[model samples]
Target: MLVPLVIGMSAPSGLEGGELAAVVARGELVWAADQEGGGPHVFPDPDAPQRLTGFEVELAELIAAELGVKARFQQGQWDRLPLLLGHPADCVINGIELLPERRRDYHCSRPYFAYGLQLIARRDGPLDTVETLTAPGPAGRWRVGVLTGSAAELFLRSHPELEVDAIGYDGTIDSLEQVKSGVLDAALMDDCIFNFYADRFAGLRAVGRPFGGGYYTVLTARDTPRLSTAIDEALGRIIADGRLKTLYDRWDLGGRQQILALRDAAEIPVATRRSLRELAIETLPLLLSAAGMTVLLACLSFPLAIFAGLGVALGRLYGPAWLRPLLTGFVEVVRGTPLMLQLYAIFFLLPKVGLALPALVAAVAGLALNYAAYESEIYRAGLKAVPLGQFEAAVALGMTKWQALRHVVVPQAVRLVMPPVTNDFIALFKDTSVCSVITVIELTKRYSVLALSTGRIVELAVITAILYLAMSWPLSLLSRRFETGQEQRP
Candidate 1:
């Protein structure tokens, strides 16, 4: 059997120096994912690809370099990483907590970094500190926004008596936006994240002190001991030599000394980290569920496109001349516009026009309609490619026009169109990422969400791209088979 691949290492934050060095020395490659807006692990750097750069990137590269391997990165939305584990990456980096439930499924590295939640509020807001918000009666009802899947979010969820209105946003920037716009009275995030935003977003400040110590550990496959050991050693070395601190300073995270101090104090025992294999195991099921949606959408939409394209082709080719223009116009409009725009219009805008559809239906409809237009052209070309001599031959044989066209013209036309039509479906499958914007929750959307949550953009994106390739590769084989069959036809 092939040696099981060592795929990912979920870090506490985005790639910083240590993680990158570890991967480099071990000759292990890594894929990094990041949030849509900068998360503690991931951030938007104008110079980076897809506008993402952060601790995750630096650490992932360092680890990869230490391993003598390559480091790649990706961008995704938060709240989706757990669902993307195993399918797209080996594990995510960033201080992922080792919960009892998660421990059963995932193996975790020794704690590398630690931090705590910080409450932030606008300069002119009502509450300045966590204590005031926790103080007396009605004031406790003040809304607090927290990025979903963060430690702060989990803390808020566990304490219902606090009476804080908890809103789960996908990114720190979004949570900050709610606070800045006065939509939320305050927001809670990691101290490093709060500091990053407080400086970038004017009129916002970190209030009171940080709360609840949390350690950051690398999450990986529960069964992969060799991979886990390699990464742990790399991380340990990086921490010992002060490379990790260099990264902290580079990102201006050195200012959060207290946060780092807490991490050092609460370090989880090495034996405990080793015992946490179960945490990584459950991750696969969740990721597979999301991957299933991706496959389902692609499969369902493709057949619909074939039928819709055929109908459209018939209309354009055989319908009345006046009707042809209308059919042609419809195809043109769909083909001309971006599929992403179509998905949004169908999912978000169409509901306003009294035509509401579920997110999945809208996604399927948008993809099918978009591909049908391209398919129609392929079909039309196929029809036109049928020689006039075939019709003449049919007439000479005393066959009816309908019978001749159906038996002779269509079969050949279908054979001719098969390749291009197949190509269109492959393209459509990849393009399904656009549906993620409207919450269709397909592969791309899942990857995007996972990236945002874990700040491992490169890894998530690579897995997503691979998933697309896996789907397309089979379709390509089928297309080639059809082409071979066509050639063999008597």
Candidate 2:
């Protein structure tokens, strides 16, 4: 989802030091946001699918114009924005709140917007207020959904006595949909977001006073102090020129943002200090839990792929004439389409027909089916590489046709196939990260969540990369051992 700037029009400036200057030099100020968060902050414009239009989008544009550069937008998962800074984007402006920990990790601009949490519930639902369902009875049982890494979740998590069964999701629309459909008792998110959906969903209504939120600031990397300063100054000018207020009015972010912008109340959050060893010790357990899922994905699906692939390969090569073409078509179809589409089909699309599967089952099934196509090719090559004389020799020795293949050809072909098989197996380890789309919390997804939740993107990513290496290295060693043993075989 990292949409890079593709406009061919280039303008080059020769300035130095700051990210702002660098962006100006390149003729584009690349801003990153995750559209999944949705609504008045940043989402795709319905009338124009390819364009983004929100207060934050407009805010980025004004600042870019202030620095005399074009605004380029890139999309990354919301939890991964901090990681994308300085890599794919010069800064991020997706209504990132002015949290204490965020200020510590990133070179954040002064607050441009201020808002609070809005508790949203079904209009006809029994829950009317936060205190309404807090009574001591069966009716007090409430299942609330919150965006996984938001302050709403943090607030709810701090109060276990509330006995709220909290559900975490990555997007706003899903939680709202769940609330509307009675799947969730209520949903909590930003007031600005609630405003975007207020008129759109007649069944959903925002209730209770908006509470417990702070200013939203733009984030740049800590290394880019010069760029940070430029952002601060540009934002100041935008406020003074009334452009900031115009955006707030246009986007319905309430008049409170204008007051906060004019008042300029920005405090840097204190940074946490820890040794490398301390950091590693803190993060390893969480990473390890996620790594276990990744390993499970590879381990569960791979042998199935091997067995299915070998069967298909044999059928294609030596089955009845009518079956050969069918097996060949199966290989072509599976290989031709993307693995992502296959996952969506199994997990998202199939449920319409009542074949609903759990996330893990869908992920394993999708991976097995996808890999079987490639594995069949590897197997077919190995089968063909077996000299015909070997089969002839076995058949001449009173072995049945199936017996010759099972005992002689397959055993030899498997040896030749082992090296590539092991290599694919290792590659499949990393590929399991994509299973996050199906809600399987593999290593990479865990890293994103932990990184955002704890504001330790760099530390978590280093540990995660090591975990991935740890998963694949053993397979590499095993493959090398097989290769050496194969070479030593005669």
Candidate 3:
């Protein structure tokens, strides 16, 4: 019997368990991303509760049914889904495009659906067609908003004079709203998505025709060859037997047929395929460049965190009774919440409250604030670890409370906290990847951009990991040395 496998569902309309009955019988399981409210590629219909109804869901259900497995659903962020592939889910069934770079890390199922890049403009805008929008003049130079890390943004970036105002939104609907509110002149998005929202907004319209034919494929982990083959065959069968066509008709995706045909012929051209040596050489500079940014961010943020943590620790340990509670609550709140959400709040929400900050500055501030909260706890523990007799002895020697803390308490506390601080620094370095969501091109962000460009996520991610290890190993060694020296001095 086949081992039970989990397949991811991208949206509610795409696929579901009813189609995966065959796969369930064979001991396979279908797991769908809980995109209840819609994300970048998936949109939730208000009519449905905690379920999606897109092309991704329908196709995934069909695949699971064919494999005779039961289908299950779970929710995860779009960016986080890649990390979840081998763990919580066997394959991500979103309408993922099969790009050359992506093939390095994932095995993509045959193309089952297609969409194209389209321009969305406000109803009151003078620009309505692609020709008029791109025509040579100031009026034609409208700012086009796109989601960061998406193909649309990358494509726009390649054009120097396009006046792109790329925004990194957690969801496509949010990006669309920016355009609707006139915060952005226009938005470049998938045609299918534009159609879904255009009806509701009334002010938005798809400009010109769709371009850059894109197709959807199931993304499986690279190591799962057998599973990959099974998926491809199942998809091929669906297409050959006309079930795929019927599903598309039912979903009104017939307009995407030409793009699907183009996707069927897709493959990485030989000229673009680099050998291992070439790939390494090409990726080295990028990795190095991003590493420098990561180091810079960490260096700038660490000192701030340490200082803030020290202040918070002192306040909690020695402040007036009323103030102590406030400081303690502040530290606890920051520590309890996710660092990513905090960063998002700072980058996206803060600007609206008239506290705008540059992306890099916001990232550094968020990282520093997050680490400071944890570090305060660490410092407080370190402070307590110092014996009370030491302070008493300082007092006997005629030292004041402030002097005792500065001279006697702090030195010992530093030694006690040094190891944990070093460990925290290493973690902070890795956590810096979250800043990429706000457009800070740190080490991980650079790798992700390269991965999207080359479609080689596994190799690139591995290389990035190794680089991180190399950078952090020395810090680990230094922490050990500090511990040894502290022991010898005492």
Candidate 4:
């Protein structure tokens, strides 16, 4: 099975080689960050989308220059960027918060930026203030969005008494868009991020004062003490010499908040490492919960794919001449495009045509439609493999064309396609992970979140792989049994 092949790759490498020395020898400081985080941190220049420009981008270069190396950028998902440390990247320079738990797992550089959670909502919305949000609104629970695995999410989750329905998004921009569209009552994000995106979303306004303040520090692999020390020194140099101030002012972030970066930073103690068993005990529930969502998506989509594929196959093979080419084109188009693009169009672009779907529904529809095209080709071939003589024999018994095709031909075609159809269902379990882009939490997404938070990539990945195998193994056995039964039949 694909699961075993993937599980074999989950073993992580050790940090035996000196991280800082390697970077110096190469004359390059490779830093990882998520450009998708957007704005004052790091993002593509709006005027020149191909060129990335942000304060963090400049900050990375400054630190690299101080260390006598050129800075190179490696893109990764925001939450999972830490996983790239000690391999392709020496340090992570995104707006990663400096938390005690984070310090425990990774070496964090001195503060370059200070941020706090900024609550945002529609102008004059019901949940404009934190007090209103704390109280039960007309909707009973306020639906608030936060970037998943981020400090804002942690802050919101810390207060269980708020009774808010926390929705996790992959990016702050998406959460803002949701607030604008009235899908979310509010969104909480880094104050700098909201400031960066404020003018773009005019209808949304900052709801309450920014809270849960923290410093943004560059993170290095735990083993890279030298590299972390170098980064901290570089940050101190930048702050003392006013280069950090110049960069902040250029990015419109030179405000009272900038003072936090200037002050003597307090050292946060590292957290105690959790044993593998303890981590599994703590995170398994979250992963299993997410797996349930994955199962729900697969179960809801695969049957629709099968039925829709059947219709397309029948239309191409036996329907009117005028419609055959249209069905052919539909299948070709669906198969030609990427599933991600199809999902993006359905979830993000459909709103333009007044057909905005909820994230779960959109994910299921995208998976179903994409798989239907492939299944149609399989069904088409299976239908074509049936002999023309069988239809004539049925007609010789005075059966109508419809009755003959249904009673005589379809059963054989279905049998021919069953093995492949079952295999597709098996694949769907893994494919559901892609739905995370649209913010439908599934196994893979949950693994990334848990791995990032716990710094236990290998352990969580193994567990996640096992969960995926658990899901698809039964289907694999069933498909094999069905194939063997077919082989034995006379």
Candidate 5:
């Protein structure tokens, strides 16, 4: 889930020479955050999508000014924001909960924003409180949604006795929408986020007093201790001067939970790291399950893409001339766009027109459509490569044009394209990672979550890569066998 970004950025102003001196030289504090679907933390202004606004935005600016530098925002996925530290980002100012696991991996500043888990339910729903939710329910368990890789998810999963199904969504607002539509019985998110978005989602009400308190802390690379110290001091100054409170009040984040921000830095608990063997033992099953998802997504989509692409290829080559332009245009459009955008459109945009697809279905459909464009090109080439003699020979045997295509040309084309088609299947396995943005938890997303929580990036990543190889190796060998067979055949 960690996207590549350039590194070698300087740290903040307080540091003298070495890597820490870059911020003073550039006079910019490059902070990483995810503005997309990141409400109340950092999100685009509704009036002007290009402009970013949020309490965290102001907090970043405040810290930047305190460091005597300008703040520049770097956009990244929320779950992968920490990975930007020390590279493209001087620090991360998104709502990164100061969990013990994250603190164990990265340098964490003192708390700047206090928060807690807030449960949201339909205003007229029978479930009234967390206590009520914990009580024995009907035959079906209540489906409660939380943002994937969020502290809310951790808190919810920690208590199996709660007896609710914890569904993960890519965004807090997405979960709220599910609640509003009755797709979910309830949702849990940061209290600050709930406060910020409450008016936007009118049908939902807070189900109980906020629980499972935590604080949002700034994170920097472990090597940037000076920058981390400066950030901590800046946060302390912001809190002591009442500026933090004023910012919170402006954002409606002022509440009793805000007191959590006042704890001494030493009060933060130190997290213990587990050995790699222990971590592997614990996470292997989850990774295997996620790998199963990766396999399922690719297996389900590639066949569909193959069939659809073949149909498109045939239509362009042999069907009505009028249909050719439309099919060609489809190939152009789908090939021109990113698969992520296609999935986003299917999962998010389609919901507006009353065509909301379940996450897995949307993911499969998006991957199928996106790859079908490339598959069409491959098939088109394969069909074109067939010699004119093949069609003529079939026609000389009294076969119709359709019969000639079905009996002779297309089969040869499929054989010609089989290797490339298998190659695409391998590629589609990797592309399944993009489906994570739609809340489809596959291998890569699972690796990211486990790596973040367990601080075992390389170990989990190697396992994930091996799982991918294991899945694709058989196909690769099959493709080679087919190549050898064709080479031997005439």
Candidate 6:
């Protein structure tokens, strides 16, 4: 088996040093961004699906030009961008806030942009400022939305009274959309982002004063002081040359954050290191909720996969001749592609064609469809193992083909396939973690955010492994029991 060299205690990009010279030598500066971080920042160009266009995309190009290297884009989920920096990526620049935890592990550039949180609400909505909503009235409790891991979310999470049902979304667009749809009372995010995205959506208005501001900086690993310096110098040059203002003007983002970036850089606050015990106390409920989501996904997907697999197998084996080829191709096609791509197609692409599904539904459907392909093959093998002679004898005994296969052939085949089927089920259990790409938060996404925020990687990881093990071990034991019983048969 091949093992990844970068796994375990691996340093962040540049932490080993010389990240700047290495990018120049390679003739490419790999900048990581989550295009799903959404528009006005980074997102797909609707006019041209193959192209990407956003304020960040243009800013990256300017930075790369200053450094004399071609800029290359590497996409990662917004929450996972920091973790990706040390791996092949040189840095992350996608509206990443200068959080305290980031400063401890990463060396960040001077603040390129400063932004305050904007309160987004329906036009003529009852809620306004924190004061109006927090006071005793019919509006005392309101459902608000925030982007997960943003300062807005942290602020809301920090306030128990002000955040009655603060809905967390993976991106600014998702949260803002919820507000426009009346699914949420309001949403909060960078004021600049709200001005760019919310205005176009209609029925939503930015109200109340902007609050809880933070700096956006490019993040590099701690090992490369030179790379960190180079990034700061590049940003300084960008600001001095008025190129930064040009980009911001196009995006209509001029504010105190951009002003601070133009003047002397803001003094970044030193990070207060968190203790493991504190992290455990804070993260316990988060992990438990995520584990519940993981279990929910597993329970929901496996049964659907089992039924879908059964149907596809029967179609391949006993259906009409013309339909058999179509079923065969579907099984082959789904199995041939990666599950991640399938989920992306369902969650992101489907909405364009007017088949927008809720996150949970899309996640379950994607997992079930992908697993059904593999499960179909397993069932097919079992059906073949029943032998042609059994079918002939059952027919001779005056049983119709459907009746014979259902009662005798299928029953025997099911026993033959139980061991492999159980193993596939276990594999399916782990794969559910990928559903977070579509914004369905599960155990893995929760662990990542907690690990980055709490800075208790080793402890959280061990507990997470135990959580996964606790889920899978029982199934493994049951699988072994069936295998042993079969072997012991006379």
lDDT of each: 0.68, 0.79, 0.71, 0.86, 0.84, 0.80
Name the top lDDT candidate: 4
How good is model 4 by TM-score? 0.94
Cα lDDT tens digits, model 5, 1-490, are 3322112223332333344567867899999988864778899998999999998899999999998999999998777777677677889998888888888898888877777799999998888879977776554788888887788889888998887887777778878877786667899888878878888989899988989877788998877777778888998898878788788777777633474445533467779999888998999999999999999999999999999999999999998999999999999999998999899889877877778787899999999999999999999999999999999999999999999999999999999998888888888988999998877889888888887788777667778778888998998998898888889989
TM-score of predicted structure 5: 0.90
User: What lDDT does candidate 5 reach at residue 196?
Assistant: 84
When sorted by TM-score, best at the front, the candidate numbers are 4, 5, 6, 2, 3, 1
* Model 3 lDDT tens row, 1-490: 0011112222222132232333344476545353622533355656885556666567777777766664555566554455456555667776566666556656777766676889888778776777665454354456676655565766676666554545444456656665676555778876777766676778788778988756667877665566667778878887877777787676666734734584467564322567778878988897998899899889999999998998899889987799899998999899889998999788767755667676789989999999999999999999899999999999899999888998999889988899889999988988988887665777876775675566555677678878898889999998898888878886
TM-score of 6: 0.82
Q: If both were scored by TM-score, which would come out higher, candidate 1 or candidate 3?
A: 3
**TM-score of every candidate:** 0.52, 0.78, 0.73, 0.94, 0.90, 0.82
Every model: Cα RMSD to truth? 10.4, 5.6, 6.8, 2.4, 3.2, 4.2
Q: What stretches of model 4 exceed 4 Å from their correct place? A: 1-17, 261-266
**Candidates ranked, most accurate by lDDT first:** 4, 5, 6, 2, 3, 1
Highest-TM-score candidate:
4
lDDT of 6 by residue, 1-490 (tens): 0012225336445534577788899888888998877878888998997788898898888888888998899998687677676677888988888877778878888888878888888886777665665654364567677777778878887877763666667778867765665556788788878877765878888778888888888987677777778878998898887888877877778643486554755566768876677777789888989999999998999999988998899899999999899999999899889998899788766765667776789899999999888888999999998889999989999999899889889888888888999998889888988887666778877887787677566677777878888999999999998899889974
Task: Report the CA-based lDDT of candidate 3 relative to the real structure.
Answer: 0.71
lDDT of 5 at 222: 78
In model 2, the clashing pairs are none
Cα lDDT of model 4 by residue, 1-490, tens digit: 2343235334342344476777889899999999888888888988999999999999999999999999999998888788777666789999899988898888888788888789899987876677777788787889898888899888888898896978888777877887887777899999999888888999989988988778888998877777888889988898888888888888899744596554955777777899888997899999999999999999999999999998899999989999999999999899899898898788777875777788899999999999999999999999898899998999999999888879998888999888999999998888998898888888898888887788777777789889998999999999998899889986
